[model samples]
Target chain A: MVDDGGLDVVAPIGGAVRDLLRAAPGASVDLGAIDPRSTPGLPDEQLTGAERKGWARRQVELVGRDLARQQEMLFAGAKVDPDAGRRVLLVLQAMDCGGKDGTIKRVVGAMNPLGVHIRAFGPPTAEELRHHFLWRIRRALPPPGQLGVFNRSHYEDVLVPRVQERAPEHVWRPRYAEIDDFERELTAAGVVVVKVFLHISKVEQARRLLARLDDPTRHWKYHPSDVDARARWDDYQAAYADLLGRCGTDVAPWHVVPADRKWYRDWAVAHLLRETFDTLDLGYPPADFDIGRERERLLGTAGPLKVNRS
Target chain B: MVDDGGLDVVAPIGGAVRDLLRAAPGASVDLGAIDPRSTPGLPDEQLTGAERKGWARRQVELVGRDLARQQEMLFAGAKVDPDAGRRVLLVLQAMDCGGKDGTIKRVVGAMNPLGVHIRAFGPPTAEELRHHFLWRIRRALPPPGQLGVFNRSHYEDVLVPRVQERAPEHVWRPRYAEIDDFERELTAAGVVVVKVFLHISKVEQARRLLARLDDPTRHWKYHPSDVDARARWDDYQAAYADLLGRCGTDVAPWHVVPADRKWYRDWAVAHLLRETFDTLDLGYPPADFDIGRERERLLGTAGPLKVNRS
Candidate 1:
């Protein structure tokens, strides 16, 4: 019964609309179900299914290239100004077989290291576990003007322990509230987080595993025991579903990408990034004062870098 | 004079041979030119420039994926093995517009983040300047099984300020001894150090700069004042030439890559990384013990993890 207005292109789940609005203000968006009034600012073309995925891959490459280019420029100016530090925190997360690495390289491979700071989190050290679950992640945040991506994030506190039943029920369950609060603070501090769950079917993951084992170059990737984690698939999926249902928020939303399509995943990330950067009110630094005027002012003043003893 | 041998498609440099020898006790090595013999054990095709880069990038991707894989796997057999900690510290330094980032992305992009740590140094912060030049750098040394790339490194102490007269005469001059000693300590501490200087011509940089300006996305990479530094091209080149003359050592030699051809630069880094990893006797982990034997030991002991005792 909703108004079918512009060029419609989203599914009825409301994720794409939520993602766009969360990424950029005043971004009027519609997905496949509605016929929108205009498709001017739509991230992807109105194509659906396979065609849309093809377009998405090319679009992701463009967005990633654009992101790298912008980050490099802003960083070069860091010696002069620090304002370029406000880009969004793009966090990529998924289960054991999720394709975060290939996705990151394909999407942001060309970024200048000097511009974008990448931090990958591992399991808790003795000290890390002693503190709140979010402690380690908070410390690794990208300083201003950088796109910081957390490979596995604070969500682990809620996600894994719940599925594994490693922690007491009450302790792990309450963490969802804590996470929401922490994200709000990050947003308040100018960190916009885009959390993505790359949803790949178990069958696809099995195929990838087989490929890794068959290829010599990929032999390094086959950790003989990844099969054990695969056994817990149902438990993990239920946990992630609970996570997406509860933690999806207006400030920082979860994008449950149907990652069966790698091209579509790349396109979704690119679309998300463009929206994030387009919203930031960022530009070139202000000009330096006129050298002649500064010289005249220096002559008018008795004070100098070296103060007189008198 | 070094003996002349027919050049091979790929050959070992002196630094690599030394590290290989260091890894295996009593292993003999020759450093004069590419040693005459090729290892028949290594599959001939296993030694391509693309394969080398593919391996390292694959390792990094494996590490990143492992970290993001699942909580249990990250901790299952984790911790930087103390023995492997004596690995190399490979530093890549280049001219302002040279392709250091490209070198890393193409070479080690596949390696796991767990095995590599990267830091790019520009000007020192006020707090950093309070200590010795190497003070900040020492803290960034890579742990075991890791590769570290420094975009512009402490060599700048000699390369830049020395040319620009940014420091006093005695202060800048003696740092040559100071730097040599600092690296000697790293090598002595069991860290293999291979340093490179990607030498790009002024004309090449100008072309890249123009390219950056012409593309709207790339425009973010432009800053007007970088032009001021580019104007000092001749002096900086002289400074670099002098630096190479003084600092090139048997332990940590410099590879001056002619970067006009971008693919050639990529190939060089790929070759260098493969050479580095090939040196390590990265033997597989000790065999997993029989679960039945370990189970009895665990049952006989104080049992599963003790929470605590007052």
Candidate 2:
């Protein structure tokens, strides 16, 4: 199913994706918009969200496997690159318990450890809260040719603080501009920032929360605050609404996937990645110096060695 | 720190680690056991569990990074190991939402993906459950010099199936022996199996569950089924205790890591890894023929091609 003669690697990379990100800077895009272009389409009219998620999970696993192979090729004297000085930053933020860990598992599986890095940000460390919101994030940037993933990211400046009003409204508001500038810098300097907001419905979230409590294997995963937040769902929704309306720009827009169905989410993510890599136009760099050319270059300039027999 | 220097490299490759597994197959060794071997008079006034865990997390991060570098070096130019039949299988199981994902992140963060493989098992698909429990797991064993990490594994045959009563108690109970046999077979075949069970307290689980609900960005991560398991806390604990008590073995023993503290869990995993790799004694192979040796062998044996023009 070639969309346009071949794998239609659409979804603006250096173009619209980057441009919109730059324009809004801290804004998130409705990444679902990139659908049809990503997975082509599945003909299962009867598939449930969970089933879709399973399929997407498999797709992600395959993508992760692909990343692993690419990494091996690089180690084999290949000059594949992101040209991004040192990292690919993945930002995953969703309502509490949004499967960030599950997403991380499937997405990063089979990746080269040397070239992939993961940083998870929880309630900010006291030291973290004291600094500018982006401080912890800036420190986690992946080294060149590396992929750096953030379980939660600087977006929390907008997300958590806004939803909880933990920071004075005024303090948290300026962060949008600051985040825009920071991401812009990262993009211009070669870092491709991919942000995913897992959009699960409130009911699904409640269901997952209850699952945590019911599964003894999951008991350690429960928390009282989760019940508390369930009470404040409305506030979070309003905050998210404001976020979507505000942050999506040209340089580093967020990809808001409908996480209500994980399969769709996973497929969407892999598709996005395939498109991004295609856009980078990545290829093995020409050998340091062509061996043939190098031999010829020395052929005429070299003199014969002195012989001991003389 | 030395833990009795019984591991001698003179033995064929992988023999030392294998021997250790065979000896302690049933004893659940706390791989993260911090020895005071060198600190004879150190005070025992340790930080509470939380602080200790924090320190452990930092330590694991450092070690994971180092491990990552080593894997990269090996992949760069190392010869294919002659004892290339050995591989590693790391199995991590925990109460729901315990730091399984984080453990993978910190532990495998630096591993070279060229040879390592990761698989996460959830409730089996209809196809998987229809056959023997070991079907999916048996397929993922890593090749020699490679690593295979399992997030949740065959233990589920004993863990979840027991709690849910999906099969008769007799069925799951005996599967434990089967699992032991399965892992034992893996070890005999050169698989270094290391298993970890993160044990978190009920209170801690409550805190994490709450965190998911409180954070809007993390909301989709919760599920209703989680609560159902929590209500059956006693049943799960019994299942875990039975599995731990029965399955902890000399060849593939479990590490009962106290999970109240996340950092400690991380530290313990990193330490377990260091011990596993360091204990393996992956020494270099004998050198290939040098130029002199090559010349001797080549006195009559012509090399590739003589320069043109003779």
Tens-digit lDDT track for model 1 on A25-138? 222211222221122233434554345544545556556667765655445444345653455687887865578876766765546544555677766889998998888988
Cα lDDT listed for each candidate: 0.58, 0.58
Chain A TM-score per model, please list them. Answer: 0.75, 0.74
**In model 1, what lDDT does residue B134 have?**
86
Best candidate, TM-score-wise? 1
- Say which docking band candidate 2 falls in: incorrect
**Chain A vs. native, model 2, TM-score:** 0.74
User: Per-residue lDDT for A121-214 in model 2, tens only?
Assistant: 8788899878877788878776566566787777777777777777788887887777778878898887777776677665566556555544
lDDT of 2 at B194: 86
Off by over 4 Å in 1: A1-59, A70-80, A202-232, A281-310, B1-83, B86-90, B98-116, B160-174, B188-192, B200-239, B259-310
lDDT value, candidate 2, whole model: 0.58
True contacts kept of 1: 0.01
